[model samples]
Target: MAASETPLRLSDRAGAQAFVQNLLAVMSELESALGRESDGVRAGRIAEAMTGAAAKADLAAAYTTGLETAKANAIALARFAPEGLEALKTAQRRFAAVLETNQQVLATARTVSEELIKALAEEVGKAHTPTVYGRPSHSPSPYGRAGANSGPLILSRSL
Candidate 1:
Protein backbone atom coordinates (compact mmCIF):
# COMPACT_ATOMS: atom_id res chain seq x y z
CA MET A 1 0.00 0.00 0.00
CA ALA A 2 1.06 3.58 -0.51
CA ALA A 3 1.96 5.59 2.53
CA SER A 4 -1.39 7.36 2.36
CA GLU A 5 -3.20 4.03 2.28
CA THR A 6 -1.09 2.56 5.08
CA PRO A 7 -1.83 2.91 8.76
CA LEU A 8 -0.13 5.90 10.28
CA ARG A 9 2.25 5.81 13.20
CA LEU A 10 2.23 8.91 15.43
CA SER A 11 5.31 10.33 13.68
CA ASP A 12 3.85 9.56 10.25
CA ARG A 13 0.60 11.29 11.18
CA ALA A 14 2.41 14.52 11.98
CA GLY A 15 4.34 14.30 8.70
CA ALA A 16 1.14 13.68 6.81
CA GLN A 17 -0.52 16.70 8.36
CA ALA A 18 2.43 18.86 7.39
CA PHE A 19 2.30 17.52 3.86
CA VAL A 20 -1.39 18.35 3.57
CA GLN A 21 -0.79 21.84 4.93
CA ASN A 22 1.93 22.49 2.37
CA LEU A 23 -0.30 21.29 -0.42
CA LEU A 24 -3.07 23.58 0.72
CA ALA A 25 -0.69 26.53 0.82
CA VAL A 26 0.52 25.84 -2.68
CA MET A 27 -3.03 25.60 -3.96
CA SER A 28 -3.79 28.95 -2.38
CA GLU A 29 -0.84 30.54 -4.15
CA LEU A 30 -1.88 29.05 -7.45
CA GLU A 31 -5.37 30.43 -7.04
CA SER A 32 -3.94 33.87 -6.44
CA ALA A 33 -1.74 33.67 -9.52
CA LEU A 34 -4.59 32.54 -11.69
CA GLY A 35 -6.73 35.38 -10.40
CA ARG A 36 -4.04 37.91 -11.20
CA GLU A 37 -3.58 36.51 -14.67
CA SER A 38 -7.29 36.59 -15.29
CA ASP A 39 -7.50 40.20 -14.16
CA GLY A 40 -4.59 41.22 -16.33
CA VAL A 41 -6.09 39.60 -19.37
CA ARG A 42 -9.46 41.20 -18.74
CA ALA A 43 -7.74 44.57 -18.57
CA GLY A 44 -5.75 43.88 -21.76
CA ARG A 45 -2.44 43.64 -19.99
CA ILE A 46 -1.30 40.33 -21.34
CA ALA A 47 2.39 41.12 -20.85
CA GLU A 48 1.76 41.65 -17.17
CA ALA A 49 -0.31 38.49 -17.01
CA MET A 50 2.49 36.47 -18.60
CA THR A 51 4.84 37.59 -15.84
CA GLY A 52 3.03 35.21 -13.48
CA ALA A 53 3.94 32.17 -15.59
CA ALA A 54 7.10 31.24 -13.73
CA ALA A 55 5.49 31.61 -10.32
CA LYS A 56 2.54 29.54 -11.45
CA ALA A 57 4.81 26.81 -12.84
CA ASP A 58 6.83 26.59 -9.62
CA LEU A 59 3.75 26.53 -7.41
CA ALA A 60 2.08 23.95 -9.65
CA ALA A 61 5.06 21.62 -9.32
CA ALA A 62 5.12 22.01 -5.55
CA TYR A 63 1.39 21.42 -5.39
CA THR A 64 1.73 18.28 -7.48
CA THR A 65 4.42 16.87 -5.22
CA GLY A 66 2.46 17.63 -2.09
CA LEU A 67 -0.66 16.17 -3.64
CA GLU A 68 1.15 12.93 -4.41
CA THR A 69 2.39 12.73 -0.84
CA ALA A 70 -1.09 13.42 0.46
CA LYS A 71 -2.53 10.68 -1.71
CA ALA A 72 0.11 8.23 -0.54
CA ASN A 73 -0.70 9.16 3.03
CA ALA A 74 -4.48 9.37 2.54
CA ILE A 75 -5.40 6.78 5.17
CA ALA A 76 -3.14 8.31 7.76
CA LEU A 77 -4.38 11.79 6.85
CA ALA A 78 -8.02 10.79 7.22
CA ARG A 79 -7.35 9.10 10.51
CA PHE A 80 -5.29 11.95 11.94
CA ALA A 81 -6.52 15.03 10.06
CA PRO A 82 -9.84 14.60 8.41
CA GLU A 83 -10.46 18.34 8.47
CA GLY A 84 -7.26 19.12 6.60
CA LEU A 85 -8.08 16.54 3.92
CA GLU A 86 -11.48 18.11 3.43
CA ALA A 87 -9.93 21.57 3.23
CA LEU A 88 -7.55 20.34 0.54
CA LYS A 89 -10.42 18.97 -1.47
CA THR A 90 -12.26 22.26 -1.21
CA ALA A 91 -9.21 24.22 -2.26
CA GLN A 92 -8.70 21.92 -5.24
CA ARG A 93 -12.22 22.64 -6.47
CA ARG A 94 -11.75 26.39 -6.14
CA PHE A 95 -8.40 26.18 -7.91
CA ALA A 96 -9.99 24.29 -10.78
CA ALA A 97 -12.63 26.98 -11.23
CA VAL A 98 -10.04 29.74 -11.19
CA LEU A 99 -8.01 27.88 -13.80
CA GLU A 100 -11.05 27.62 -16.02
CA THR A 101 -11.64 31.35 -15.80
CA ASN A 102 -8.02 32.01 -16.61
CA GLN A 103 -8.32 29.87 -19.72
CA GLN A 104 -11.40 31.73 -20.91
CA VAL A 105 -9.81 35.13 -20.34
CA LEU A 106 -6.66 34.20 -22.23
CA ALA A 107 -8.64 32.82 -25.11
CA THR A 108 -10.60 36.05 -25.32
CA ALA A 109 -7.38 38.02 -25.40
CA ARG A 110 -6.02 35.87 -28.24
CA THR A 111 -9.16 36.34 -30.31
CA VAL A 112 -9.33 40.09 -29.77
CA SER A 113 -5.68 40.48 -30.71
CA GLU A 114 -6.05 38.43 -33.86
CA GLU A 115 -9.07 40.41 -35.00
CA LEU A 116 -7.38 43.74 -34.30
CA ILE A 117 -4.34 42.71 -36.29
CA LYS A 118 -6.43 41.58 -39.21
CA ALA A 119 -8.42 44.81 -39.27
CA LEU A 120 -5.31 46.96 -39.10
CA ALA A 121 -3.68 44.98 -41.90
CA GLU A 122 -6.71 45.43 -44.11
CA GLU A 123 -6.77 49.19 -43.53
CA VAL A 124 -3.05 49.56 -44.21
CA GLY A 125 -3.27 47.44 -47.33
CA LYS A 126 -6.11 49.63 -48.58
CA ALA A 127 -4.09 52.80 -48.11
CA HIS A 128 -1.07 51.44 -49.99
CA THR A 129 -2.92 49.99 -52.97
CA PRO A 130 -2.97 52.54 -55.80
CA THR A 131 -6.44 53.71 -56.93
CA VAL A 132 -7.50 52.31 -60.25
CA TYR A 133 -10.22 54.26 -62.16
CA GLY A 134 -11.08 56.23 -58.98
CA ARG A 135 -11.87 53.12 -56.98
CA PRO A 136 -9.70 50.84 -54.83
CA SER A 137 -10.22 47.83 -57.09
CA HIS A 138 -6.67 46.75 -56.25
CA SER A 139 -7.04 47.38 -52.50
CA PRO A 140 -7.15 44.54 -50.07
CA SER A 141 -10.14 44.30 -47.74
CA PRO A 142 -11.54 41.31 -45.88
CA TYR A 143 -12.25 40.04 -49.40
CA GLY A 144 -9.60 39.41 -52.00
CA ARG A 145 -8.04 42.39 -53.80
CA ALA A 146 -8.35 42.74 -57.56
CA GLY A 147 -6.09 40.54 -59.68
CA ALA A 148 -5.31 38.37 -56.63
CA ASN A 149 -7.28 35.48 -55.07
CA SER A 150 -6.35 37.12 -51.78
CA GLY A 151 -3.42 39.15 -50.64
CA PRO A 152 -0.92 37.23 -48.61
CA LEU A 153 -2.09 37.12 -44.97
CA ILE A 154 0.63 36.00 -42.62
CA LEU A 155 -0.17 35.57 -38.98
CA SER A 156 2.32 34.83 -36.25
CA ARG A 157 0.59 33.60 -33.12
CA SER A 158 3.67 33.11 -31.03
CA LEU A 159 2.08 35.19 -28.32
Candidate 2:
Protein backbone atom coordinates (compact mmCIF):
# COMPACT_ATOMS: atom_id res chain seq x y z
CA MET A 1 0.00 0.00 0.00
CA ALA A 2 3.03 2.29 -0.14
CA ALA A 3 3.28 5.01 -2.76
CA SER A 4 5.21 2.88 -5.21
CA GLU A 5 3.64 -0.48 -4.38
CA THR A 6 1.65 -2.39 -7.03
CA PRO A 7 -0.73 -5.01 -5.79
CA LEU A 8 0.69 -8.50 -6.41
CA ARG A 9 -1.13 -11.42 -8.02
CA LEU A 10 1.08 -14.42 -7.31
CA SER A 11 -1.05 -17.15 -8.95
CA ASP A 12 0.63 -19.90 -10.96
CA ARG A 13 -0.87 -18.44 -14.15
CA ALA A 14 0.69 -15.03 -13.45
CA GLY A 15 4.21 -16.59 -13.59
CA ALA A 16 7.30 -14.53 -14.41
CA GLN A 17 5.43 -11.37 -15.28
CA ALA A 18 3.86 -11.21 -11.86
CA PHE A 19 7.12 -11.83 -10.03
CA VAL A 20 9.08 -9.31 -12.07
CA GLN A 21 6.43 -6.63 -11.76
CA ASN A 22 5.96 -7.09 -8.05
CA LEU A 23 9.70 -7.12 -7.49
CA LEU A 24 10.02 -3.89 -9.46
CA ALA A 25 7.29 -2.33 -7.37
CA VAL A 26 9.08 -3.37 -4.16
CA MET A 27 12.38 -2.04 -5.48
CA SER A 28 10.80 1.29 -6.40
CA GLU A 29 9.14 1.62 -3.01
CA LEU A 30 12.39 0.75 -1.24
CA GLU A 31 14.25 3.36 -3.28
CA SER A 32 11.61 5.92 -2.36
CA ALA A 33 11.98 4.99 1.30
CA LEU A 34 15.75 5.39 1.15
CA GLY A 35 15.45 8.70 -0.69
CA ARG A 36 13.07 10.01 1.93
CA GLU A 37 15.49 8.96 4.67
CA SER A 38 18.43 10.57 2.89
CA ASP A 39 16.54 13.81 2.32
CA GLY A 40 15.28 13.88 5.90
CA VAL A 41 18.76 13.34 7.30
CA ARG A 42 20.22 15.97 4.99
CA ALA A 43 17.57 18.47 6.12
CA GLY A 44 17.96 17.46 9.81
CA ARG A 45 14.49 15.95 9.87
CA ILE A 46 15.66 12.87 11.73
CA ALA A 47 12.23 11.78 12.94
CA GLU A 48 10.67 12.08 9.52
CA ALA A 49 13.54 10.00 8.10
CA MET A 50 12.85 7.20 10.58
CA THR A 51 9.08 7.17 10.24
CA GLY A 52 9.02 4.63 7.41
CA ALA A 53 11.78 2.38 8.68
CA ALA A 54 9.50 -0.59 9.37
CA ALA A 55 7.96 -0.23 5.92
CA LYS A 56 11.42 -0.04 4.40
CA ALA A 57 12.42 -3.21 6.23
CA ASP A 58 9.34 -4.93 4.90
CA LEU A 59 10.13 -3.84 1.35
CA ALA A 60 13.72 -4.98 1.70
CA ALA A 61 12.62 -8.42 2.91
CA ALA A 62 10.15 -8.69 0.07
CA TYR A 63 12.75 -7.68 -2.47
CA THR A 64 15.15 -10.29 -1.10
CA THR A 65 12.53 -13.02 -1.26
CA GLY A 66 11.60 -12.04 -4.81
CA LEU A 67 15.23 -12.20 -5.92
CA GLU A 68 15.65 -15.65 -4.42
CA THR A 69 12.48 -16.91 -6.09
CA ALA A 70 13.48 -15.43 -9.43
CA LYS A 71 16.98 -16.86 -9.24
CA ALA A 72 15.54 -20.30 -8.57
CA ASN A 73 13.34 -19.97 -11.66
CA ALA A 74 15.73 -18.04 -13.89
CA ILE A 75 14.81 -20.14 -16.94
CA ALA A 76 11.14 -19.45 -16.49
CA LEU A 77 11.75 -15.74 -16.10
CA ALA A 78 14.00 -15.61 -19.17
CA ARG A 79 11.54 -17.54 -21.28
CA PHE A 80 8.28 -16.01 -20.16
CA ALA A 81 9.33 -12.51 -19.09
CA PRO A 82 12.39 -11.57 -21.11
CA GLU A 83 11.28 -7.97 -21.42
CA GLY A 84 10.39 -7.82 -17.78
CA LEU A 85 13.78 -9.27 -16.87
CA GLU A 86 15.49 -6.61 -18.96
CA ALA A 87 13.43 -3.93 -17.24
CA LEU A 88 14.34 -5.45 -13.89
CA LYS A 89 18.03 -5.20 -14.74
CA THR A 90 17.64 -1.54 -15.63
CA ALA A 91 15.68 -0.90 -12.45
CA GLN A 92 18.30 -2.73 -10.39
CA ARG A 93 21.04 -0.53 -11.84
CA ARG A 94 19.08 2.60 -10.96
CA PHE A 95 18.38 1.24 -7.49
CA ALA A 96 22.10 0.64 -6.96
CA ALA A 97 22.74 4.29 -7.73
CA VAL A 98 20.11 5.37 -5.23
CA LEU A 99 21.61 3.06 -2.60
CA GLU A 100 25.04 4.58 -3.16
CA THR A 101 23.69 8.07 -2.62
CA ASN A 102 21.85 6.95 0.50
CA GLN A 103 25.06 5.44 1.89
CA GLN A 104 26.99 8.65 1.24
CA VAL A 105 24.34 10.72 2.98
CA LEU A 106 24.35 8.42 6.01
CA ALA A 107 28.15 8.44 6.13
CA THR A 108 28.22 12.24 6.07
CA ALA A 109 25.73 12.38 8.91
CA ARG A 110 27.84 9.92 10.96
CA THR A 111 31.02 11.91 10.34
CA VAL A 112 29.36 15.16 11.41
CA SER A 113 28.00 13.56 14.54
CA GLU A 114 31.41 12.10 15.47
CA GLU A 115 33.01 15.52 14.95
CA LEU A 116 30.41 17.22 17.16
CA ILE A 117 30.99 14.68 19.91
CA LYS A 118 34.75 15.03 19.58
CA ALA A 119 34.48 18.79 19.90
CA LEU A 120 32.36 18.45 23.02
CA ALA A 121 34.79 15.92 24.49
CA GLU A 122 37.74 18.21 23.79
CA GLU A 123 35.99 21.12 25.49
CA VAL A 124 35.27 18.96 28.53
CA GLY A 125 38.87 17.74 28.57
CA LYS A 126 40.11 21.34 28.51
CA ALA A 127 38.02 22.31 31.55
CA HIS A 128 39.54 19.47 33.61
CA THR A 129 43.22 19.62 32.47
CA PRO A 130 45.85 21.55 34.43
CA THR A 131 47.21 24.62 32.68
CA VAL A 132 50.30 26.85 32.83
CA TYR A 133 50.73 30.26 31.10
CA GLY A 134 47.25 29.81 29.46
CA ARG A 135 48.34 26.48 27.94
CA PRO A 136 47.30 22.97 28.93
CA SER A 137 49.85 20.78 30.67
CA HIS A 138 49.22 17.96 28.27
CA SER A 139 50.57 18.79 24.83
CA PRO A 140 48.87 17.55 21.65
CA SER A 141 51.27 14.59 21.44
CA PRO A 142 52.32 13.25 24.84
CA TYR A 143 54.56 10.49 23.41
CA GLY A 144 57.68 12.63 23.88
CA ARG A 145 57.66 12.36 27.69
CA ALA A 146 58.83 9.17 29.44
CA GLY A 147 55.90 7.03 30.62
CA ALA A 148 53.35 9.56 29.44
CA ASN A 149 49.86 8.57 30.52
CA SER A 150 47.18 9.28 27.94
CA GLY A 151 43.85 7.58 27.58
CA PRO A 152 41.03 7.29 25.10
CA LEU A 153 38.38 9.98 25.05
CA ILE A 154 35.58 8.55 27.10
CA LEU A 155 32.40 10.55 27.02
CA SER A 156 30.08 10.21 30.00
CA ARG A 157 26.80 8.36 29.57
CA SER A 158 25.13 11.58 30.73
CA LEU A 159 26.12 13.24 27.46
Candidate 3:
Protein backbone atom coordinates (compact mmCIF):
# COMPACT_ATOMS: atom_id res chain seq x y z
CA MET A 1 0.00 0.00 0.00
CA ALA A 2 1.12 3.57 -0.70
CA ALA A 3 2.33 5.68 2.24
CA SER A 4 -0.33 8.27 1.49
CA GLU A 5 -3.07 5.65 1.90
CA THR A 6 -1.74 4.37 5.21
CA PRO A 7 -3.79 5.22 8.28
CA LEU A 8 -2.32 7.41 11.01
CA ARG A 9 -1.69 5.89 14.45
CA LEU A 10 -4.23 6.66 17.16
CA SER A 11 -3.27 9.28 19.74
CA ASP A 12 -3.69 8.94 23.54
CA ARG A 13 -6.97 10.07 25.20
CA ALA A 14 -5.50 13.29 26.58
CA GLY A 15 -4.00 14.23 23.19
CA ALA A 16 -7.27 13.45 21.47
CA GLN A 17 -9.17 15.75 23.86
CA ALA A 18 -6.69 18.59 23.26
CA PHE A 19 -7.00 18.17 19.51
CA VAL A 20 -10.79 18.25 19.70
CA GLN A 21 -10.73 21.38 21.87
CA ASN A 22 -8.37 23.18 19.52
CA LEU A 23 -10.53 22.30 16.52
CA LEU A 24 -13.60 23.64 18.33
CA ALA A 25 -11.81 26.89 19.16
CA VAL A 26 -10.68 27.52 15.58
CA MET A 27 -14.13 26.63 14.28
CA SER A 28 -15.73 29.14 16.67
CA GLU A 29 -13.45 31.91 15.43
CA LEU A 30 -14.13 30.99 11.83
CA GLU A 31 -17.87 31.07 12.45
CA SER A 32 -17.61 34.57 13.94
CA ALA A 33 -15.55 35.89 11.04
CA LEU A 34 -18.00 34.48 8.51
CA GLY A 35 -20.90 36.14 10.35
CA ARG A 36 -19.16 39.51 10.24
CA GLU A 37 -18.39 39.09 6.57
CA SER A 38 -21.97 38.17 5.76
CA ASP A 39 -23.34 41.18 7.65
CA GLY A 40 -20.89 43.53 5.98
CA VAL A 41 -21.84 42.35 2.53
CA ARG A 42 -25.54 42.53 3.29
CA ALA A 43 -25.12 46.08 4.54
CA GLY A 44 -23.03 47.07 1.49
CA ARG A 45 -20.06 47.89 3.69
CA ILE A 46 -17.12 46.91 1.48
CA ALA A 47 -14.60 48.14 4.02
CA GLU A 48 -16.05 45.98 6.77
CA ALA A 49 -15.96 42.90 4.57
CA MET A 50 -12.38 43.60 3.51
CA THR A 51 -11.29 44.01 7.13
CA GLY A 52 -12.27 40.42 7.94
CA ALA A 53 -10.66 38.81 4.92
CA ALA A 54 -7.28 38.27 6.54
CA ALA A 55 -8.74 37.02 9.78
CA LYS A 56 -11.09 34.64 8.01
CA ALA A 57 -8.26 33.25 5.92
CA ASP A 58 -6.15 32.63 9.02
CA LEU A 59 -8.93 30.95 10.94
CA ALA A 60 -9.86 28.75 7.98
CA ALA A 61 -6.29 27.52 7.74
CA ALA A 62 -6.14 26.74 11.45
CA TYR A 63 -9.45 24.89 11.30
CA THR A 64 -8.27 22.70 8.46
CA THR A 65 -5.10 21.81 10.35
CA GLY A 66 -7.09 20.89 13.44
CA LEU A 67 -9.45 18.68 11.44
CA GLU A 68 -6.58 16.75 9.93
CA THR A 69 -5.10 16.16 13.37
CA ALA A 70 -8.42 14.95 14.66
CA LYS A 71 -8.86 12.54 11.77
CA ALA A 72 -5.48 11.02 12.48
CA ASN A 73 -6.52 10.47 16.06
CA ALA A 74 -10.12 9.44 15.41
CA ILE A 75 -9.74 5.87 16.73
CA ALA A 76 -8.30 7.07 20.01
CA LEU A 77 -10.95 9.76 20.30
CA ALA A 78 -13.75 7.24 19.74
CA ARG A 79 -12.35 4.91 22.38
CA PHE A 80 -11.75 7.73 24.90
CA ALA A 81 -14.73 10.06 24.62
CA PRO A 82 -17.53 9.32 22.20
CA GLU A 83 -19.37 12.36 23.58
CA GLY A 84 -16.62 14.71 22.51
CA LEU A 85 -16.68 13.24 19.03
CA GLU A 86 -20.44 13.74 18.83
CA ALA A 87 -20.07 17.39 19.92
CA LEU A 88 -17.49 17.98 17.21
CA LYS A 89 -19.82 16.49 14.65
CA THR A 90 -22.62 18.80 15.77
CA ALA A 91 -20.37 21.84 15.57
CA GLN A 92 -19.32 20.81 12.06
CA ARG A 93 -22.95 20.72 10.91
CA ARG A 94 -23.56 24.23 12.28
CA PHE A 95 -20.43 25.52 10.56
CA ALA A 96 -21.56 24.05 7.26
CA ALA A 97 -24.86 25.92 7.43
CA VAL A 98 -23.17 29.24 8.13
CA LEU A 99 -20.69 28.62 5.32
CA GLU A 100 -23.52 28.05 2.86
CA THR A 101 -25.19 31.32 3.82
CA ASN A 102 -21.95 33.24 3.53
CA GLN A 103 -21.39 31.81 0.04
CA GLN A 104 -24.84 32.93 -1.10
CA VAL A 105 -24.24 36.46 0.13
CA LEU A 106 -20.88 36.70 -1.60
CA ALA A 107 -22.36 35.39 -4.84
CA THR A 108 -25.07 38.04 -4.75
CA ALA A 109 -22.51 40.79 -4.21
CA ARG A 110 -20.43 39.60 -7.17
CA THR A 111 -23.44 39.50 -9.49
CA VAL A 112 -24.50 43.02 -8.47
CA SER A 113 -20.98 44.35 -9.04
CA GLU A 114 -20.79 42.76 -12.50
CA GLU A 115 -24.15 44.27 -13.53
CA LEU A 116 -23.13 47.74 -12.32
CA ILE A 117 -19.89 47.58 -14.31
CA LYS A 118 -21.74 46.54 -17.47
CA ALA A 119 -24.20 49.45 -17.12
CA LEU A 120 -21.36 51.91 -16.62
CA ALA A 121 -19.54 50.58 -19.68
CA GLU A 122 -22.63 50.99 -21.86
CA GLU A 123 -23.13 54.58 -20.71
CA VAL A 124 -19.50 55.44 -21.29
CA GLY A 125 -19.65 53.98 -24.82
CA LYS A 126 -22.71 56.03 -25.66
CA ALA A 127 -21.16 59.27 -24.36
CA HIS A 128 -17.81 58.83 -26.16
CA THR A 129 -19.38 57.79 -29.50
CA PRO A 130 -19.06 60.60 -32.07
CA THR A 131 -22.11 62.11 -33.83
CA VAL A 132 -22.35 61.63 -37.58
CA TYR A 133 -23.05 64.65 -39.78
CA GLY A 134 -25.93 64.44 -42.29
CA ARG A 135 -26.29 66.20 -45.66
CA PRO A 136 -28.66 69.18 -45.73
CA SER A 137 -31.34 68.78 -42.98
CA HIS A 138 -31.50 65.00 -42.85
CA SER A 139 -31.80 63.69 -39.25
CA PRO A 140 -28.99 61.46 -37.99
CA SER A 141 -29.48 58.01 -36.48
CA PRO A 142 -30.69 58.01 -32.83
CA TYR A 143 -27.48 56.21 -31.96
CA GLY A 144 -24.58 58.00 -33.64
CA ARG A 145 -23.11 56.06 -36.63
CA ALA A 146 -19.87 55.82 -34.67
CA GLY A 147 -21.72 54.08 -31.82
CA ALA A 148 -22.50 51.07 -34.04
CA ASN A 149 -18.83 50.72 -35.03
CA SER A 150 -17.40 51.27 -31.53
CA GLY A 151 -14.81 48.75 -30.30
CA PRO A 152 -15.84 46.07 -27.82
CA LEU A 153 -16.03 47.38 -24.24
CA ILE A 154 -13.29 46.17 -21.92
CA LEU A 155 -13.89 45.99 -18.18
CA SER A 156 -11.01 45.92 -15.68
CA ARG A 157 -11.80 43.61 -12.76
CA SER A 158 -9.03 44.34 -10.28
CA LEU A 159 -11.40 43.65 -7.45
Candidate 4:
Protein backbone atom coordinates (compact mmCIF):
# COMPACT_ATOMS: atom_id res chain seq x y z
CA MET A 1 0.00 0.00 0.00
CA ALA A 2 0.91 3.67 -0.11
CA ALA A 3 2.87 5.40 2.66
CA SER A 4 -0.29 7.13 3.90
CA GLU A 5 -1.98 3.76 4.25
CA THR A 6 0.61 2.62 6.78
CA PRO A 7 -0.68 2.40 10.33
CA LEU A 8 0.50 5.03 12.72
CA ARG A 9 2.74 3.85 15.54
CA LEU A 10 1.05 3.52 18.91
CA SER A 11 3.02 2.92 22.12
CA ASP A 12 0.36 2.93 24.85
CA ARG A 13 -3.30 3.18 25.95
CA ALA A 14 -3.08 6.95 26.04
CA GLY A 15 -2.09 6.97 22.38
CA ALA A 16 -5.07 4.77 21.55
CA GLN A 17 -7.44 7.06 23.44
CA ALA A 18 -5.98 10.08 21.66
CA PHE A 19 -6.51 8.44 18.30
CA VAL A 20 -10.18 7.71 19.03
CA GLN A 21 -10.73 11.24 20.34
CA ASN A 22 -9.10 12.72 17.28
CA LEU A 23 -11.29 10.61 14.99
CA LEU A 24 -14.36 11.73 16.90
CA ALA A 25 -13.40 15.38 16.40
CA VAL A 26 -12.78 14.84 12.72
CA MET A 27 -16.18 13.17 12.34
CA SER A 28 -17.95 16.06 14.05
CA GLU A 29 -16.35 18.68 11.83
CA LEU A 30 -16.92 16.63 8.72
CA GLU A 31 -20.54 16.10 9.64
CA SER A 32 -21.09 19.84 10.00
CA ALA A 33 -19.34 20.59 6.74
CA LEU A 34 -21.37 17.98 4.89
CA GLY A 35 -24.58 19.40 6.30
CA ARG A 36 -23.70 22.87 5.03
CA GLU A 37 -22.76 21.66 1.57
CA SER A 38 -25.91 19.56 1.27
CA ASP A 39 -28.13 22.43 2.32
CA GLY A 40 -26.33 24.98 0.19
CA VAL A 41 -26.59 22.86 -2.92
CA ARG A 42 -30.22 21.98 -2.30
CA ALA A 43 -31.02 25.67 -2.02
CA GLY A 44 -29.16 26.52 -5.28
CA ARG A 45 -26.40 28.47 -3.53
CA ILE A 46 -23.59 26.86 -5.54
CA ALA A 47 -20.85 29.13 -4.27
CA GLU A 48 -21.78 28.42 -0.65
CA ALA A 49 -21.82 24.72 -1.45
CA MET A 50 -18.18 24.87 -2.54
CA THR A 51 -16.84 26.78 0.45
CA GLY A 52 -16.23 23.66 2.55
CA ALA A 53 -14.08 21.66 0.12
CA ALA A 54 -10.70 22.69 1.56
CA ALA A 55 -11.84 22.21 5.14
CA LYS A 56 -13.32 18.79 4.30
CA ALA A 57 -10.10 17.72 2.56
CA ASP A 58 -8.04 18.62 5.63
CA LEU A 59 -10.50 16.88 7.94
CA ALA A 60 -10.43 13.79 5.72
CA ALA A 61 -6.63 13.59 6.02
CA ALA A 62 -6.83 13.89 9.80
CA TYR A 63 -9.59 11.30 9.89
CA THR A 64 -7.49 8.83 7.93
CA THR A 65 -4.48 9.36 10.17
CA GLY A 66 -6.54 8.83 13.32
CA LEU A 67 -8.29 5.77 11.90
CA GLU A 68 -4.98 4.21 10.92
CA THR A 69 -3.80 4.59 14.47
CA ALA A 70 -7.09 3.28 15.87
CA LYS A 71 -7.24 0.18 13.66
CA ALA A 72 -3.65 -0.76 14.49
CA ASN A 73 -4.22 -0.49 18.24
CA ALA A 74 -7.78 -1.77 18.55
CA ILE A 75 -6.86 -4.18 21.34
CA ALA A 76 -5.02 -1.50 23.23
CA LEU A 77 -7.92 0.88 22.81
CA ALA A 78 -10.38 -1.68 24.09
CA ARG A 79 -8.18 -2.30 27.12
CA PHE A 80 -7.66 1.39 27.84
CA ALA A 81 -10.33 3.62 26.37
CA PRO A 82 -13.30 1.34 26.07
CA GLU A 83 -15.67 4.22 26.76
CA GLY A 84 -14.02 6.31 24.07
CA LEU A 85 -14.35 3.40 21.67
CA GLU A 86 -18.07 3.28 22.34
CA ALA A 87 -18.31 7.03 21.70
CA LEU A 88 -16.43 6.60 18.49
CA LYS A 89 -18.83 3.87 17.38
CA THR A 90 -21.83 6.09 18.02
CA ALA A 91 -20.16 8.98 16.23
CA GLN A 92 -19.45 6.72 13.31
CA ARG A 93 -23.12 5.81 13.02
CA ARG A 94 -24.17 9.45 13.08
CA PHE A 95 -21.48 10.33 10.59
CA ALA A 96 -22.70 7.56 8.32
CA ALA A 97 -26.22 9.03 8.40
CA VAL A 98 -24.89 12.48 7.51
CA LEU A 99 -22.94 10.99 4.64
CA GLU A 100 -26.03 9.26 3.31
CA THR A 101 -27.97 12.50 3.34
CA ASN A 102 -25.16 14.33 1.63
CA GLN A 103 -24.92 11.66 -1.01
CA GLN A 104 -28.61 11.89 -1.78
CA VAL A 105 -28.44 15.67 -2.06
CA LEU A 106 -25.48 15.58 -4.39
CA ALA A 107 -27.14 12.97 -6.56
CA THR A 108 -30.27 15.09 -6.79
CA ALA A 109 -28.16 18.10 -7.76
CA ARG A 110 -26.56 16.13 -10.59
CA THR A 111 -29.88 14.87 -11.89
CA VAL A 112 -31.45 18.31 -11.77
CA SER A 113 -28.50 19.89 -13.55
CA GLU A 114 -28.46 17.21 -16.25
CA GLU A 115 -32.19 17.47 -16.91
CA LEU A 116 -32.05 21.27 -16.96
CA ILE A 117 -29.19 21.26 -19.47
CA LYS A 118 -30.91 18.73 -21.73
CA ALA A 119 -34.17 20.71 -21.71
CA LEU A 120 -32.30 23.93 -22.44
CA ALA A 121 -30.41 22.33 -25.27
CA GLU A 122 -33.64 21.06 -26.85
CA GLU A 123 -35.21 24.49 -26.57
CA VAL A 124 -32.16 26.14 -28.13
CA GLY A 125 -32.25 23.61 -30.96
CA LYS A 126 -35.92 24.28 -31.64
CA ALA A 127 -35.35 28.04 -31.61
CA HIS A 128 -32.67 27.72 -34.28
CA THR A 129 -34.73 25.43 -36.54
CA PRO A 130 -35.98 26.99 -39.81
CA THR A 131 -39.76 27.47 -39.88
CA VAL A 132 -42.15 27.99 -42.80
CA TYR A 133 -44.34 30.30 -40.69
CA GLY A 134 -43.57 33.20 -38.29
CA ARG A 135 -40.23 33.91 -36.60
CA PRO A 136 -38.66 31.10 -34.55
CA SER A 137 -39.06 31.50 -30.80
CA HIS A 138 -36.11 32.97 -28.91
CA SER A 139 -35.79 33.21 -25.13
CA PRO A 140 -33.59 35.89 -23.67
CA SER A 141 -30.47 34.45 -22.03
CA PRO A 142 -30.24 34.93 -18.26
CA TYR A 143 -26.61 36.09 -18.39
CA GLY A 144 -26.85 37.62 -21.86
CA ARG A 145 -25.25 35.73 -24.81
CA ALA A 146 -21.75 37.11 -24.24
CA GLY A 147 -21.84 36.86 -20.44
CA ALA A 148 -23.13 33.28 -20.64
CA ASN A 149 -19.94 32.21 -22.40
CA SER A 150 -17.66 34.24 -20.13
CA GLY A 151 -17.08 31.26 -17.84
CA PRO A 152 -17.85 27.58 -17.64
CA LEU A 153 -19.84 26.04 -14.81
CA ILE A 154 -17.80 23.63 -12.74
CA LEU A 155 -19.37 21.09 -10.43
CA SER A 156 -17.32 18.78 -8.25
CA ARG A 157 -18.75 15.39 -7.32
CA SER A 158 -16.61 15.05 -4.24
CA LEU A 159 -17.53 16.50 -0.89
TM, every model: 0.73, 0.77, 0.75, 0.76
Error of 4 at 127 (Å): 0.7
Model 3 regions more than 4 Å off: 1-10, 130-159
TM-score for candidate 1: 0.73
Deviation in Å, model 3, residue 116 alpha carbon = 0.4
Consecutive 10-residue window with the lowest summed lDDT within model 4: 146-155
Model 3: lDDT of residue 147: 45
Point out where model 4 deviates above 4 Å: 1-6, 132-159
Q: On residues 13-100, what C-alpha lDDT tens digit does candidate 2 reach at each position?
A: 3577878888999999999999999999999887778889999999999988787777777777777788988999999999999999
What does candidate 1's lDDT look like per residue over 30-135, in tens digits? Answer: 8899899899889877788889899999988877767666776778888888888899889888888888988998888889887999898888677666777887
Per-residue lDDT for 1-159 in model 3, tens only? 235755435556776677778778889999999999999999998676778788888899888767776777777889976788998999999999999999999999999998998898878776656655732232356765534555677766444
| Candidate 4 local distance difference test against the native | 0.79
Report lDDT per candidate.
Answer: 0.78, 0.81, 0.79, 0.79
Count clashing residue pairs per candidate: 5, 0, 0, 0
Candidate 2 lDDT (Cα, 0 to 1): 0.81
